[model samples]
Structure formats: C-alpha cells, structure tokens
Target: MTNSISLLAEEQVPESYGWLAGGIGAVIVIALLVFWVASLISIIRSGYSVGVKILLAMAAFAYPFLGPLIWFLFARHKEHKTRMDR
Candidate 1:
C-alpha cells in the first residue's frame, strides 16, 4: 500500500510540471509569431536600407536571446575609427 501511494505521488508531480512547461512553450511561440509579423510590417513601411532593415527585422522577431546579440553586433553603428586607423 505504501509503494502504491508513492507511485501515485510521483505521477502527480510530473503531470503538474508537464502542464507548466506546455503553457510556457505556447507563450513563447505566440510572442515569436506576433513579433515576426510586426517587424515585417515596420520594415515595409519605413523602407529602411537593406542592411538596417534586415537588422531591425531580425531584432524585432527572434528568440528572446537573439535580440541582444543583433543589437550589439549589427544593429548599432560600427565604429569607423579602428585601432589600425589611429
């Protein structure tokens, strides 16, 4: 009887986690889709330069981790005065 009770307890724990994970996954996917659409629309309206447009579009709709990388690397203006220029 004790073994059966432990098994039931273990099963309930995983079922709860499964629901939580599924909810989080759904939210991420929805946000990604919404951002992707908004980015495309803004890109079209502004008619930004190809490079800038690409960067903005990518930043607007990417995995949460990707936006910062794009911002630091390509989205911001590059420093024209390099050490070699000095």
Candidate 2:
C-alpha cells in the first residue's frame, strides 16, 4: 500500500512544473507548425507538379529534417540540374 501511494505521488506532477511543461509543449508545437508551413510553401514554389508537391509537403511536415533533406537531394536538386543542363 505504501509503495502504491508513493507511486501515485510520484506520478502526480506539481502545478508549477505542469505549467512549465505546458508552456514548453506549446512552444514546440508552434515551432513545428511554423516549420511545416514554411516547408510546404517551399515545396509549392519549387515548380513541382501537384502530386509531388503534396507528397514532399507531407513528408516535410511529418518527418522534420530528414524529409526536407531527402526531398532536396532527390527532387529539388535534380530539377535544378535538369534546368541548368537545358
């Protein structure tokens, strides 16, 4: 019984800590949303077709840095070279 009580106490977050945690969470969420919107805009402006733009935007929003890196390497950069070569 004492162990269970201690566990419950440990699980209960202090109010101050809770507010701090909530603020931090809000910041993280806002940052991610900003990043997603920026990435989506970049994808849209890159002259890709609708399907590719949607795919890259989704990837950039969902997977963070890796998604943009892959898109840059495989799609954006490839198109740049093709245009330059032309």
Candidate 3:
C-alpha cells in the first residue's frame, strides 16, 4: 500500500511538470507563428519578393520582434525606392 501511494505521487509530479512545460512551449510556438504571419503581411502590403517575404517571416520564429523592424528599415525602404513593387 505504501509503495503504491509513493508510486502514484511520483507519477503525478512528472505528469504535472510535463503539462507545465508543454503549455509554455506551446505559447512560445504560437507567438512565433503569429509574429511570422504579421511580418509576412507587412511585407506583402509593401510589395516585396515572395521569396524574400517568406524568408523574412521565418526570421520572426527566432527573434519575434526583431524581424519586422529589420524588414521595415531595409526591405520596405528599398521597395519604396524601386517604386515598381508598391
């Protein structure tokens, strides 16, 4: 009986920890995806290369906030100068 109780307790601890970790990881992945999509939309609105947009979107997955800033400063600025895209 004592062994069974201890085993149950041990199982519960790992399961709880697993749930917490999974929740946090899921949140991070979702945030990454949302930021990536937002970057894609911004690039699309400004009329950049489709391939370049895809690459820029992928970057948000790693550095969620930085991707758009870089795109705005570099890609969007150049797109304007080209003026053919917009």
- Which numbered prediction scores highest in TM-score against the true structure? 2
- Report the C-alpha lDDT of model 3 over 15-59, residue by residue, as the tens digit: 659778778989998986776677778876766567766676687
Candidate 1 lDDT at 21 equals: 70
Q: Which window of 10 residues has the lowest lDDT sum in candidate 1?
A: 77-86
Best by lDDT: 2
CA shift at 35, candidate 3, in angstroms? Answer: 0.8
Displacement of residue 21 (Cα, Å) in model 3 is: 0.3
Q: Is candidate 2 or candidate 3 better by lDDT?
A: 2
User: In model 3, which range of ten residues has the least summed lDDT?
Assistant: 77-86
lDDT for each residue of candidate 1 in 8-54, tens digit (9 for 90 to 100): 87777697597787799899989866655654664545534577666
lDDT per model, in order?
0.60, 0.73, 0.72
lDDT of 1: 0.60
